[model samples]
Target chain A: MKTAALILSAVLAVAACVFLLAPLVVVVLASFSPTPVFDLPTTGASLRWYGRIANLEGFWPALGLSIEVAAVSTALALVVGTLAAIAAVRGALPYADAFAALLVSPLMMPGLVLGIALLQYFRAVGFDAPLAGLLVAHLIVTLPYVARTMIAGLSRFDFTLIDAALTLGCTWRQAIFKVMVPALAPSFLIAGLFAFLASFDNYPVSIFLTDVRTKTLPIKMLQYIEEAPDPTIAAVSSLILLGTIVLLIIADRAVGLSRMAGTSD
Target chain B: MPVTSLSRRTLLKASAALAGTVAMPSIVRAAPKEIVIGGPAGAAKYFNESVFPLLKQKLGVTVLYEGTNSLTNLQKMQADKAAPKFSVVIMDDPVMIRAAAEGLIVPMQASAIPNLGKLVPGAVHLDGMWANYQLPWAGIAYNTKSGAPTSWADMWAPSHKGKVIVPSIQNTEGFWNLLIAAHLETGKPLAEAQYDIDAGFRKLKSLVPSLLNVYTNAPQAMNLLEQGEADMIGGQFSAYTLTRKMDGAPVDLAIPKEGGFAMPSGIAKITGGPASDLADAVIDAFLGPDVQQVLATKAVVTPTNLTTPRPAGYPDPATLFAPDWGFVAKERGKWAERWTTELL
Candidate 1:
């Protein structure tokens, strides 16, 4: 009976992985398809679609904008979200739970609703800068991921370590930099990763804010699909998937994947 | 020290006020000699690749193209109505009607666009607020291996049962499908039969059994036909079908004996936009013979210009159905609701 249970559990886990990973595998295969139509490459592979990705209309600018927005928004959200998490967990502020909920409330709202509301609010406030509006909206989108992870991390933290460091003749800033930050390093990395990915691939909010010249990678990919349904978009998707894998590998090297997965210390 | 602090605060306030006055207008102001045009992604791709360079060379005007669907463009226009961003917009005829009604677009001066006079009849709106640059007809697209279908009624034939893919009513092709059904049911000319929505719904209800599935995306439907998973796709555009055929898909668009509907891609200038002359010039260039030829051959659309000869292998324009778009604009909501409840 014990052997059967272990086998059954292992089988289910493999099935789940396949279910999640099959589409990604298909996309990677389709990127190398020799034909223009999106089909499995029974006719053998070619690098034609990959070569075409660079010449796609407005491809480079869209990629640059997506990276810039994701990097900036993730950086800002980390600072703001980490500080807010500390306040809620350690400051003994009144209504801390409510404040935390409010910080993460945007996550519960539908992206379309949030996008429309932000577009309207910006219009009403006479904010006509598309790039600025996009960054601010992305900050709102990324903050929830950071705050949720940081709050969970801070809850498990030992605040007395910072007090001990201060008693050892360290200044308050030095104690925090030397003790608290390093202790919470894994959470920071995971939160930043999640926040960056969230902002990077956002479509609904970005769509509302993007103008003629300003578009993110997801919006550009959608436009390419609309323009012509071909394997070029699959190539773009495959590259993005590969990039995400590299990021994960680097994160794993910095901190154990198990820690990021929250399965073990 | 108090006086120094007060003076510094005063200096900061004055500088901030000065900066606001200088920066606000520049943010809102349109760049001179540049016109932003919004339209579908495919059409924008064509213009960006072929037409914009010509406009730049001939008129020295820079064109910025915004590529999205028509309804989104309408919403963007509405949001930016106070200080409009788009100098020109291209939309489907139904959406163009709504845009005109909402005062989002103003009529083009005929004198400003000499090429407007050269468009085929029914290519320009009655009010002259917009003109069709390309005519993509909606008809049956079938896999060549199954042989060509000759009439819209052929969809209901026993042989094609459970082998046809009709578009979901959310797509404009679905509306065209309903109209085709109406034309068949009433046995009247398409122009007159299109008004009888009840008969159309009744006819489409009978076609439900023959349908394999309802598709929302055109390319996916084309893929099914190419793979021979489906025999026919009802109400697909000629341009898209022909483009696929040219790309070696085993598919062809057929204009049935009853006639196909013209889903004209319409262009219009935005109201109260900057660089009105440049916008007009862009419209003229779009309608001119050279650009129209490129539209026909490269973009695979039927050019609206009368001077531009129809490309070989395209269906004649005269046989195609041209609906009263005003009626469609008014009744679309009701028909969509009926389509959802009754058909889906």
Candidate 2:
């Protein structure tokens, strides 16, 4: 009976992995298809679709904007979210639970609602700057991921470690930079990854904010599909998937994936 | 370890510089000679690839193309009505009527756009608020392998059961399909049948059994037909299917004996736009003979310019039907509700 249960569990795990990863596998294979239409490369593979990606209208600028917005928003969210999390967890402020909920409330709201509301609010405040508006909007999008992860990480932390560092002749700032930060390194990496991805792929919110010249990668991909339904978008998707995998591998090397996933200490 | 730290520091500095550059106001502000236009992605792609360079060479005016759907472009114009960013806007006929009603677009003068007189009859709005650039007719698109449909009534045939795709009422193609169904059921002319909403809904309900699915996206529906997953797609556009056919897809659009409806792609000058003359020049360029030829051959759209020759093997413009878009704009919401509750 015990052996049967183990086999069932292993089968279910494999099934779940296949279910999650099947679409990605199909997309990657479709990217190399010889035909223009989206299909698996059963007959043969070609690099023609990948070659077309660079020449796609407004592609390069869109890619540059997406990376810049994602990197900046993720970095800002980490600092602001970490400080907000610390205040909620350790500062013993009034309505601490309420504050944390409010901090993550944007996640509960639908992206469309948030986008329309932000667009209207920005208009009312006379904020005409497009890039700044997009950055602010992305900051709203990414903050929840960082805050939720950091809050959870900080809750599990022991405050005595900071005290012990200070006792060993370290300054108050040094205690945080050396001891606390290094201890929560896994959570930081995980949070940053999630935050960057959330900002990078955001569409509903970014759609309202993007102007003629300022568009993100996801918006550009959708436009390409609209202009012509072909395998070129599949090539772009494959490259993005490969980029994400590389990021994951680097994170794994720096801090074990098991720890980042919170399956182990 | 030192190398790693140096690289990390450099990365931080680079990011900070990027953020600063994005936030900073431009120190060198030149007198702008650009006109911004809003349209669908496909149209924008065509203009950017084939038309914008010519505009720059001839008039020395740069074109900034904003690509999105018709409704989003309308919304953007509405939001920026006080000081509209788009000098010209391209949208479907129904949405252009709405834009006219909302005063988002202004009428064009014949003196300003010399090519306005060169368009086919009924191509320009009666109020001269907008003009059609390209004509995409709605008809039955089918996989050649599954054989061809000859008339609108052929959609109800037994042989095609569960092998047809119809557009959802949200799409403009859906409006065309509903009108066609009404015409067949009521035995009225296409224009009068558009008002017979009950007849349209009743006929469309009977078609539900023959339908594989209702599609909101046109390209995805065309893909299904191209892959032979579905035998026929109702209310598919001529330009879209023809483009796919040229790419070697086994798809062909048939203007049945009952006649197909014209879904004209229209352009208008935005009210309160900064560059009014530039907008007029751009509109003139779009309607000119050379641009019309490019649109017909490369974009696979039927041109509105009277002088431009139609692409080989395309049906005569006289065979296509044109609906009263003003009525469509008014009754679309009511029709959409009935369409959803009954047909869907």
Candidate 3:
């Protein structure tokens, strides 16, 4: 019975993977297909659409925009989020639970609502239609990831060393930077990765804030797809989706996915 | 440089790009031949039927349909000058005129497609674009349970306060509705539609608190109506046909007394793309008789060519109200800004 159940589970797992991955596979195929629409068997195979992607003017700028936003957001999230986590774990604040909850609030809000709300709020506060607005909006949504990761890293950290540092008369700031930071380096890195992916893939906030010059890849893709639904979208989306997965794989390979997984929780 | 020089760690990334290139359709271009058409996929089907066939028989070229939304297609045409990708763009009139002003489209000789004479008056020669298609109907759509709303004013009846839905005034249709609603509230014709704008804005603002959702797309709201989620909302002339087609739902299009809103879409010639001639061929097909018959059956979308007959179970286009296209074009941006401020 157990063996039968195990076989069933394996089949189910494969089926689920196929269900999730087939559309992506078909899209990858469709992106390269000669025919404009997805239909019956084609003559053989093709690559003109991918070439079209390479040649499209929006391709490079959008990709660069996505990468830059993700990188900046991740780096800042790592630093600020790690510090917050270390401080809370060190028992620096009263009502730390409330503070932690507040830090993670952006994660609970839907991206679309958060984007529009930020747009309206920022406009009312006089920061509308600018790159600074996009950055600030992105920062708010990504801060929670850093803080959440930092919290886990802090919990797993060896506090005795910090206690010794306190006994040794080192400043709290000095101990945090020199001692606490190294112990929680893995968590900080994991948080940074999460923040980068979130910012990189973010469309709602990016689209709202994006003007002519500040447009990101996803926004360009949205604009193009809305104007023209063709095989080019499959090619572009596949490129982005694969880029993200590859980035995740690199992160997992370089630093243990488990440490990040633990920190993620 | 050899692709092998790519970082060993980034091989996966390198392979993906290479694989993408390897899989593209192998259609050879001997002398740079293709017809690049930019329009909604539904709009592009005429390319398959009318234009592509004619292009092959006459010009000896294949066409690529770049099915997309109205706004960005125009932007793409503007950007692609040196080596154009699209030969023709079938899009909304506002974008087409905007492109013409921007000098994105090449001016056409009246000698070509003499069928321009069949188009409605406002659809005639603009700076560089011409109206080849139009949707001369727009007004509030109500839940069948709310009874027929014969005019725009009935949508504001106290009963619909909690259930009322309106399209997002951010889109072109939304601003168009804003202009029409303003005119309807004051009981004016299209020429006098502008005189009573402020009263309409103020009246529209009052319903802000009661709105359930600001819908963006037309078809999506029609779905909500069939589900019985909306008591009243804005819609196209053909909302009734789609609902009736799907399980005999009693949803219907309401032609308001002040005359249903008039909005027309136009086709602009893009300088880029080898397939432009094909795009023209498609436009010719759109004006042809075959597709118009199919279009009529689906919805009450008015075909541009006056020669075509109305579909069975659809209203005659003659009965619907039409506003000044030139005036609407001029006022679109300002009205859009107002809508953003007032409705969004």
Best TM-score among the predictions, by candidate number: 2
Measured against the true structure, the TM-scores of the candidates, in listed sequence, are 0.89, 0.90, 0.53
Better of 2 and 3 by DockQ: 2
lDDT of 3 by residue, B200-222 (tens): 67768876765777765444555
lDDT digits (tens) for residues A50-155 of candidate 1: 9998888789978988887897788778887987898889879999999999999999999999999999999899898787799889999999999999999999
**Model 1, runs deviating above 4 Å:** A167-171, B1-32, B168-172
Which regions of candidate 2 deviate over 4 angstroms? A92-98, A152-180, B1-31, B188-197
DockQ of 1: 0.28
Q: By TM-score, rank the candidates, best first.
A: 2, 1, 3
Q: Calculate the i-RMS of every candidate, to one decimal place.
A: 7.4, 6.2, 14.4
Give the lDDT of residue A137 in candidate 3: 77
The CA lDDT of each predicted structure is 0.85, 0.85, 0.63
Question: Model 2, A89-122: lDDT tens per residue?
Answer: 9989999999999999989999999999999999
lDDT of residue A145 for candidate 1:
91
Q: Is the docking of candidate 2 incorrect, acceptable, medium or high quality?
A: acceptable
